[model samples]
Target: MDTTLQDPLVGRLLDGRYRVDARVAVGGMATVYRAVDTRLDRVLALKVMHPDLATDAAFVERFMREAKSVARLAHPNVVGVFDQGADGAYVYLAMEYVAGCTLRDVLRERGALPPRAAFDVLEPVLAALGAAHRAGFVHRDMKPENVLIGDDGRVKVADFGLVRAVGSATDTTGAVLGTVSYLAPEQIEHGTADTRADVYACGVVLYEMLTGAKPHSGDTPAQVLYRHLNTDVPAPSAVVPGLPAELDELVACATARDPEARPYDAVALLALAREARAALSEEQLDAVPPQARAQVRSGAEDRTSVIPRVLPLPVEHTSRLPAPPDPGPAPGRGPVTVHRRTAFLVVAAVLLSLGLGTGVWYINSGQFTRVPAVLGQTEAQATQRLADAGLDVGTTERAYSDVYERGTVMAVDPAPGERIRGNGTVTLTLSRGPRIVKVPNLKGTPLEEAKKALAAEGLAPGVITYAFSRSVAQGAVIGSDPEPGTERSPDSAVALQVSRGAPIEVPDLTGESVPDATATLQEAGLKVVVAAERIHSPEDAGTVAAQSLAEGSRAAKGDTITLTVSKGPRMVAVPDVVGMKTDEARGELEAAGFRVKVEKTFPFLGDTVTGQSVEGGTNAPEGSAVTITIKGL
Candidate 1:
């Protein structure tokens, strides 16, 4: 088979207006071509389902539904569908024609794009996906091939609603419809897909764009699928030596095995991609040499003047169609005729019939149908109301609201009572309610105090406690309750604590003179009292000789104790007993309470005192000592 053989659809008229020019791309179920709209004289892309697939009623119904679903989508980055119709054996969709390479083509040509360039490319795709997600459509099979970059550097995402048909078990013709390298972990394992599934695929696309390699791979599709299920995806940095930490983190986040680990949906991923694009480091920018940057600038130049290659269509045996009439002409190539007269007549008849039918439609189109007001109503109510009004309730969307209750209608497009064409769509936005967040208060306070304040504000306080002092005393309320100003729920509790005075220990003042101790005790807020005591020495007179209580005892306040002071010792005088017998002298000294020290100097041999040196009972306090002397014979 000659690869150069042209597709039969090329230059063929479709629906009597669109003329297929060149094949652009072919997928499992459809072949897309560049076409010229004769009626509008504009270039358009046409996707025609394979005749074999269209033969199946189920596939045809799904294809038509998918077309309708995607046609409802309106976004700058998304390719717009113009019309959908069945012409003979062909079911084709006229869509927007973008004249740029697919991101796949770019990837094949340049192994890996710069990290910045990758994000720049992905930003629009994510935006498109986000819009679809918000509209409740999931682009389950997101990949670089579905992305197209225009010569003007505009990015447009294609292939929105066809994924359902591709994933259907009945549609399995053994052709792998999806790019295996990009399937998410759950998409591979459970074959379950959702908005987050799309996010995971987008992450894989970004990874390949950044590192020039898929995060996971195997010898076969099944192996690749297994890898997605079992293995952890390595970061882009691991493949390319020096990718930005943030970009690496983003890739990891996007390709996470757990769907919940990835961004909630494309909208969140789009936000992250935009942030990554803006935050590209100077080093990454500098790494792309001026020459390489120039190539990127120059590669973006228009090359439409040189005819690009047309995508090849699957070879099939052609069945002969009725011949068209030959028009007589006298050019160098004899009578110029294309097809037999019968074929031309049939074609003319079809065109004529369509024109008449369209004219009838135009006249009938003047009929007015009022779109009922369905704002602020539930989906079921809105649908019933629209049905009652002979209008169709089309798209339903969930959106955040500040005033409206959840599940209630936020708004509707093509406002009520407006005249609209037959089967016009009614876009409804459902309310999710305003965002509510618990208040966090930390104001005019120390760290601990602030934390308590926040807790009282109904927010779980994060402790950032650090010792701080203000007019507030140490370890006291620096200032709290609720910080100076913060929004909090009514009747919320605010934490508070009073300050504790500085630490102190009682002073011990034990033994000291009464005068000195009095001064010391007075300074320490203690009073001193004197207790009576007798002293033996004059030097010890009137001093604090003893205390009623021992020292070093703990007392709180106003405790009293007595101290004993000293008076001088009393002196006793000597008593005299002379010229009497020894027993009589001892008796006299004994009566005076003085022990006698007697010495006998008498010449008489008897043991008796003859004389005394001092008289008895001398003036003295208490007992006095007496000295005795005796005369010799």
Candidate 2:
């Protein structure tokens, strides 16, 4: 059944931009959907917070903050965040959609993977987490389900909704945020998460990939949490025999109960993992334990042949028996007598044929010899090793490799120790050293295009710092470290400096307080410099009245903005404009900075000032209003 057809969100447009196409997966806090950005005409994954969780303002804010943080990461191995917004009760984050299965799916279908396959997935996952850790973000929840293996064989870390800055306080009052099976001891106990917490989770994932089961399992989540806090993760070899000791050490170092004992961060753990891989021999690396479902399937013939036979089949007799009629003929002649010697010979002959057939089958197909380990060895060395094992070299191939040296054996057919006929041949694949490429000149290229260029050259985009440059266009690359034309190893990160464009328009700050004006200017990428001298003005004291640069004028980033603060209004004496014609009094008072009013008696009208609110010589604040009273006489 197509369950996605029943989802209400399916076929609905979210925020009028993302057209939700299909429900991808549901989690405790959100439901992820495969959606297309109608406006941008691109596909992306939309993670909508569950309506219940969206109601919590704190949770929603944290979720959106996660979107912003992950968006800043910009790592190739990390899923990118495109946009974040809400449509009524649905708060969604549009993310880069990876069209492939999760690591969880691989484990479920294949059980324990071969060491090579396991490392192939783990390395990229670690790289992604390492980038996050270096950028001061921690993926609090790391699990097999969050590791996305794309159809193009790219591994990306997804679902960073629980990501938080390193050393940030976690919610200790309520339920923990991560899956219990992959939780670190510190996370389970105090609800504190750091880079080490993610390291621990990655170790657990690695263990699962090696053993086809989680390192710790319990009947309930609480039980699992308890175990995480009290018990240490067992070695993978404990469950899957023949696993290399180096892998055991790597898992142990990462899954240590004490966060202090584990690697400080994902990058440190990644280095350790690489070191372990380098130290392992091809035999150790390719060893397939009995627990591996793939190995079991590959050895199916051996298992099937080992089944014991319950009973032997009877041999067919060509000659028809003389039957009971021979009994009557026995009296007449010896012809009715059974030929016991002939019957015994016939039975022996049939048994001999069966024995010969069994011998031939064992020699041709059942008998086997183990393939010799020859990885990392030179072609000549590998050939000699195979010859020692009574095997011949069949085909020699060459391929580029970053890990293996040139002319060294990178891999072998049938792996290192799989069983094969004694006369079988092994194919050797030799390495051609690391792939190197010259960094292209990305100056003046758009930031996005520059990133793509780096990726095309097998390089990764590193920290991006922005600066104001008149020569370089806005949102374009200013330059890069290591310069252009420099050769670098594949997947090396190159630091980039992007242009923030021409100076920004400085907003007018008149009538705003010093702090408010300073903040407003800072937001526009301008620095504030308050003038020490105070000036009398109509504006309130401490308010900005004048600026060094005119309003609506452009100023470069970090440009100083001088602001003149206002003092209280100046005091001025009121002018007496009474007992004179209204026009004369108004003109005379206005000349002296005072207003005039007319007054008249009851039965007659007169254009003359009568009374004033303030005394003639009394001082009043400048720009303050003065009232004049008029009477009819």
Candidate 3:
């Protein structure tokens, strides 16, 4: 059925910008579609949150967060997010459209892949993840389905909807969000995840690619989850026999039950994968195991096996003779006369030819040869050994090792005793010694620069925490996990404590009373200093008029928060109106910013002014009252 036609979103324009054309894929959280940007006229993938999920505020936030998070990452192998918006019920993110199948598709068709092919796919995946991990984001859901293998062979990691900042608490409230097959043990047990979880998923992916099957499987998701938490992931070699030991070790390192035993991040795992690839011989990398689906016939013997066999036909001979001569002879003598040796010889020759052809086919194409053992040998020595055995070195790579000396071979592909063609190539992995590194002192270094320094020293910048520092500047490193002078493996994460300068946020004290504002500022780790002289202002008397630091501005502990108090409105002088007309006095007093009230001493009196309050011409508070007594007739 063409489900895309039934989908309402198909053929509709989303946000009036993206013209959704056809549905590409559907996932638990959202449905992906092929769309064109009407404004930009570029093809892209539109990931629209499911209507049900969109109604949930938390899910919508997480969906939009995926867009924002992926957009910040500018790596080539990471899928790009161009825009995020909503059109009616459809909230969608327009992402870069990769036109090809997924790693899962390849596995479904080909079963297990050769080591080289598996590495080819896995290395790019790890590269994309390494970028995300370094950027301090974890791809909480990493599976073959999220790995997009473009038609042009470019690999991209997608679907960061579950991504969260490192050190975030796990959600034990509900079922985990990732596929059961790829979920890390911690993710299954505690619902917690970190960069190492992604590493574990990639390791499981690598295992799947090498063996053409998952490490653990069950009838239900719960059972699978239980296995992830309880069982150790068996090595790929266990299923695909003859897989390189380095591969087993790589899988073991990645899928370790304990998160701490795994690589700190994808970048570290990538290094190990490259090292494993280097140690394998070409024959080992391309070796076709029994578990792989037989898709193509590689040799002439396979071609011959498909040809129809020619069956021998039943033979009958009729002998014609002069009628009476044979009648007198015995019946046994008559049959002996008809025997033809020439015909029998021809039949025998054809059968002999068929037998010889089958033998030639087997000798020319069906013969197998064993890969010579070449462990612990130099690259030149390994190459010469393979050449003496009619094989060639395919690829050479260096890997860190504690047992093998530097420049000597550490491992070989086909496991030193696997069967391969004589003309095949052997990949040699040379030793680079142990990967030991010291934690560099990053104290006093800027946070961003400290991260770069750690990366340069073959270390990863782990979780960042902030603290108030008296001597160190803000955004500078206060210390690190494992501290300085500690020796650790390469790509180990070093947690950094960065100085937050001083713990202070200036309080908004515009209208607060002097006492209240002072207490608030003091409580916020600041010293309050009130100016001695009061300033005249419109604000209420004794309220704060101004502050040294602006509202919400950052400040250091014990930093003084200078304040200017308000003394209320300025006072105005009252005008003198003694012996003046009552109306004139009232007008003069009112004009001098004082309210006037008349006090008549006699009824029906003349409009002459009488005694006035405050003796007139005296200063009183602004907007104060003045009283004057008028004389009667």
Candidate 4:
């Protein structure tokens, strides 16, 4: 699609005002050329849409829509669109031309960038995204190909017009747009666009910059979309060991399945990028080779050695045991003072002989084997090493940890091979890693406030569901999954339900006729169902008389309402109660599902069962209670 001309648009005027120069670059949909606005005497980049695309009415409409949308955005990092028009068969956009290679070019030349350099590249991308997001625009097609690195090392994001085309899906069936590898889960699942979607693509670009490879790639775009939907991106640390944990968290947060699960937008991402870069630099210095450290200086003022000092043990009464109680001479030895004195010497000689014999035996048999040190080693390695040292391995316990690799021993008691006797249990304290508590309930809280709460607890944001809620105002969270106050492990997902708008009320027309009622309900945006019933009044015969739930109640769309229709008036023999008091008989009749009609009691029937008509039980339409004529005799 490269257009060459000697006297070509090179100095030739366009639209009788702007003069075009040499072609700069060619792309699938447009050709960029260096041009000058003759009237303003300023340099500009002329981007002419492919003539083929211009022929498609639909593409032209979409391109114009994009142009209109991008024209509203004003951002420093975003390449601005100055003018858009059609001349004869060609459509062109005059834009600000950045005079540098693209991020793709840098990546191709450098293979994999250093951590800091990658951060440098992504920082500006995030900035541009942040600005677009703030301006109510999402850069849907964010990829390295659309990022231009200027000769001044400034990175400017191009192709802002592409967002409108991609975000607004023309096909209702949810087609994938832009580069599939960087598509967010929601974008693929619902054809929904949001700020996080761009954040996700930028994250993939950052990953590519660091690893010299895209985290998600496949043979086809569809395959890539599927992977983005189903697969979790492995942490950068996993691929390149020693990568900063902060960087990994940043990437993971951006690529989270839920849109609200990511950092608020690219604005926050840029801030996090700076912090990650600093932290990584500090870490890299500490991880330098020992030889390098030694060559530096004697007292290099080490910042990493912040661990507190501990005191050494001193030797004192090292092997002492509790003294045994001495026993006095027996009572039977007291025959007299003289007899006692003689008995004392004989007893003393016996004690002295016993003590001398015990001392010789104690020294001969009390040697103990020292416990061997086996802490901080893998289970298999530690077990084998312990066995080789004539020591029996003890039980093992596993726990999640960030410090020790999984299955490594955290510590051992009676450490290694300390010997007392034969069989002994060495209490091993395995590294379970760090403790993690789940995210707490954040519903009803502001998003920023909830995020702060989650950050304090070491948990991350998860899915954010939006729905219209009358109770909860718009933008306010209605509820959250894992519910509020539920404990979760660190990095646990925090789902939120945000309010969309006010809820709509459903009309109650349960008593209306079927045809008339259906029309009325539909007009009021309510669904209806009719059920048959038999009633006594013309108002209740073969017509909807009652509603399942009361009318004027608040309900959302698609809520079902049942209608009770009449099957004409039904009759049955009235229950007989000759003498029972009015209140007592009324309770019994009502409990039996019959409507009660009470008349003033006659003088003789204050509280007695005197007579009966229709007996105690009879078939009825379930609402007939008879009157009692008491004391007619």
Candidate 5:
């Protein structure tokens, strides 16, 4: 279904300027919508605060103040916020629109990545954060979902100014669950965040990239937060064995449970990252880990990553690099003829110097050989090439590949140009074409559990839709697209329909007592909360004045309905204008917050008022009507 069409803002002009087109994403505090600034004729992402939140005048004021501060922070990595405004009940921030997925999406699709690919993403992210940290801003909430990767391969940090709108921890389970996964121990234990906190999150991100999984897992946000407060992040190599020790050290240094033990800031951490990367050999950088899942992507796969997402670098190590010059001959040119007598003399001279000849053979030929480049070659062609280099073919094997064609040599031992023993055999692994997996049945599974199921089968969780279902429990998956047992390539997205339980019609609770309203809502399987502030309304004092949801609107069971109580109509003091001219008295009454009705005794010529309906110096409701009697002339 086109959910955007159902949104009241879609197709409606906001602030008589911005035209909201489509809903892009939803967060706990706001919903991001693709919009256009009609005045400037530019597209932007509109992050509109939830209506319930916008109701708080104090909160909106702080939100705008923080947004203005963030807008002053000009950096390429951070998402640009242009303007902040409110239209009626809607408060929004117009930000630069980036059309792409997030790091969360990439991780969901491809679990572990080769070290080179992981660094390509991590370095740029750290650089962006370094800018933020230096600017005296801390993104208290740093998660993969906030890392935007554009189609043009530019990485940007999002939701910078919005985090301060709420504290580090929230009451919502969904919000806390995603946030707690990346929080540092200090952030979890004390709810304090500084630049080092961001470094901790980056370490967790690196670990996830290296192992294709989070360092910690639990059934609830409390469990995850508890682990963060107590547990130290493990080395990536612990999961993906044989991972470089340098990478392990890097993760350990950044993810140290003690804040003082970690890097001071993202800039410091970025320097450490560079050092770690520099220490890695080409082979270590490009070696795909056992946990790295093959992706069904091709031709600039990093188009989805906003960061510098170049493909995994080819493995090229400088082993046996000290050999003497052996530029034997140039290829594709005519060879000059050599005299037979000259060649015979040279061979005889070498034979006469037996000790020197043996040393020369060992240095140049017998001791070492370079593995010839044969990636993406036919199996037969690779075998011939190996033979030409005086190397033996040890084993022939094939694995499914998304990039290479079947029967082509996709990988080789010792990689290209790496040193191999002169008598060693090179093992060639051929491509078996693309792989496919059947989607598992996930009906009746909880949402979080379903995501795990998809990950287990090397598939990624896709867009989720919520619907009201009677039979299925709330928060449980009703069904999935492509159905169970449907065949799909690895990392293919699977959309799910989750149950919202049965829908309930929200009843009007305005004018009711607080206890009565709460009892009524609780009986209807809905949660109720009274607003923190009371607003002045025509309704009686201490009575329900408004609700978050309109009367008769359909809401899912357990949906929270907020009630706004009234402090009653405002009272204004009446002015002492008795015995004055009728026109003057009428004007004074109206000015003092009263509707005026003048009555002239005869012929309507009595200009002077002897008395007024409201006694002078009396208080009345601000908008109440007041009648005046004029004495007859």
Candidate 6:
């Protein structure tokens, strides 16, 4: 049965973002889990602090702050930190997920390494540490378990939990924060660590790699700590008889009991390692120690070289042989006595033939070949460069990378510095550039929902702005600046416009006098504009007749309202029509655009108009009413 099935956090979604899949490892401080970043659509290792430590607010704060600084320290060999947060009882860090085993796994599988293989692993580890040291961080916990070897053969340094700034107090609650086996003497005695402490641990690791065993053995961790504090790490040559002097000197220099005697930092040690490698010959570089274990093969070994595969020399070269017991040949053959001159000629001829053959072989296959470094180079450049070195370009693959530019080589197979056949094909993995995502249409979405939507799409919510939108509800997104469907790099900030509900309201003001309307509009925090020309209207003179903006229109504060003044009424000469019939008068009056009314003088009989209030044919205001009397008695 899988033990992870019983782990409480195995199936939990942490911080509403990381979906934990399975527990990867459990340490004293935290439990690491293989998880998916649901928001970013990527896989990441989620290291959740143990519940006991999560309760410490100061520790949690320091952990997150350190994580933020580590996130900014971006190097190819350092595992990347993408995010950090807390949820309920879980405080976690989301890191780049490396798909391979740790150096501890490698050491357990392949006992001791030949010099070439040991150097191959050591160089990258030192490079990573050198970078961290220069950047003012000391990885106090340097152990095989913290060195990650990816399936692609890349070496990455991980778990910066115990890492701290150069001069900070190097202990928590007065307890050392490192594995007992790899802690330096200073770390054990004085509770302080610096770049030199990392160097000492690395020296111990180097000794283990070259000798297949630690210098000191103990029944318990207490014994191990006692040994680290009391004794010095032994030279590899002491354990492995044929190990080279150069490596022994390196281990001795790095593991000096006094911090002042060790290399100042990993950078200085890396320089020394390179110099030591340069001084050794090919035979010494590949010398296999007697204690090095032959890995039992169930199947073909993994070819990628984070921890390299060391090939051993022939048995005759590695093992000692004894002289024959019976020195004399058959008695008859000895008495025969072969000619010395002929034997000499034959030996000389054979030597000459061997020399010529070696020359021919050297010409045919020039020399040793290694995969050339083509990282961050364009495909064309990498191909041409590989061709120049007599190596062929193999299959090319593409992967997204934030560190390398698009179309540039991101990784190589038979990776950089690994030996290869003269004509071996080097596989290239190119960068496809940072992942691009389309901004989602967030119009009409609630502010919180829109932010969540952006995060889900691998984008960050940028500055927020509030605007009045008649069509969009309050607290809902009015629109985005990039609009919608624009392509953007992941984590790009997107600005949002949220609705502040409908704008200011404007009331009707058409029939009010100019001064009165101006005051009304001003009281409403609106500006007023009066028309230059007055127009004849039903409203009295100097009163507002029309407004520029229509009634019920939406406007904001400080908006302008235009008013047109009325010119009272217009008049013209009246024409006599006293004798005209009431129907005729009515027809004429109606035709003239005047409303007409009739009044009967007596008992209502005649249709004739005997009198008119405004004499017939008079021009009144265009839409005014006129009255007429009928003679009837």
Q: How good is model 4 by TM-score?
A: 0.41
Best by lDDT: 5
Stronger candidate by TM-score (1 vs 4): 1
Question: How are the candidates ranked when ordered by lDDT, highest leading?
Answer: 5, 6, 3, 2, 1, 4
Tens digit per residue, CA lDDT, model 3, 1-633: 245877998756678667666788876567898776756645688988788767877777766776787799999898899889888788888889876667776677667877777887889889999998898888988888888876446888997644442212233322332367888888877788889999999999988988888888766677777788889999888898888899899999999999989999999999999999999887777776666764443562232222112101111123222233334446656655544443565577668768876775455333645456565567788788888878888888888865567898666665454445668877788989878999999999999899999999899999999888878988899999989989998889999999978667776897689889988887877788899988876567999878889988888766788899988867888888988888888899888777888888666467777688777767877666788888677
Evaluated against the true structure, the overall lDDT of model 6 is: 0.77
Which pairs clash in the backbone of model 5?
Answer: 149-306, 153-306, 154-306, 155-306
- Pick by TM-score: 5 or 6, better one: 5
lDDT of 6 by residue, 421-472 (tens): 7888999999899899999999999999999999999999999998888899
Stretches > 4 Å off in candidate 4: 1-12, 56-62, 65-69, 166-178, 282-633
lDDT of 2 at 110: 60
Model 5, 173-279: lDDT tens per residue? Answer: 77677788899998777778899999999999899988988898887887887888888898888899899899999999999999999999999999999999999
What's the lDDT for residue 65 in model 3?
75
Position 44, candidate 6: lDDT: 76
Model 1 lDDT tens row, 477-579: 4433455454444445445443332322234333345687566655554556776554443224565556555565443223455666655334555555555
Residue 185 miss distance in model 3 (angstroms) = 0.9
- Local accuracy by lDDT, each model: 0.66, 0.76, 0.77, 0.64, 0.81, 0.77
TM-score, cand. 3 = 0.45
TM-score of each: 0.45, 0.45, 0.45, 0.41, 0.50, 0.48
lDDT of 2: 0.76
Whole-model lDDT for model 3 versus the true structure?
Answer: 0.77
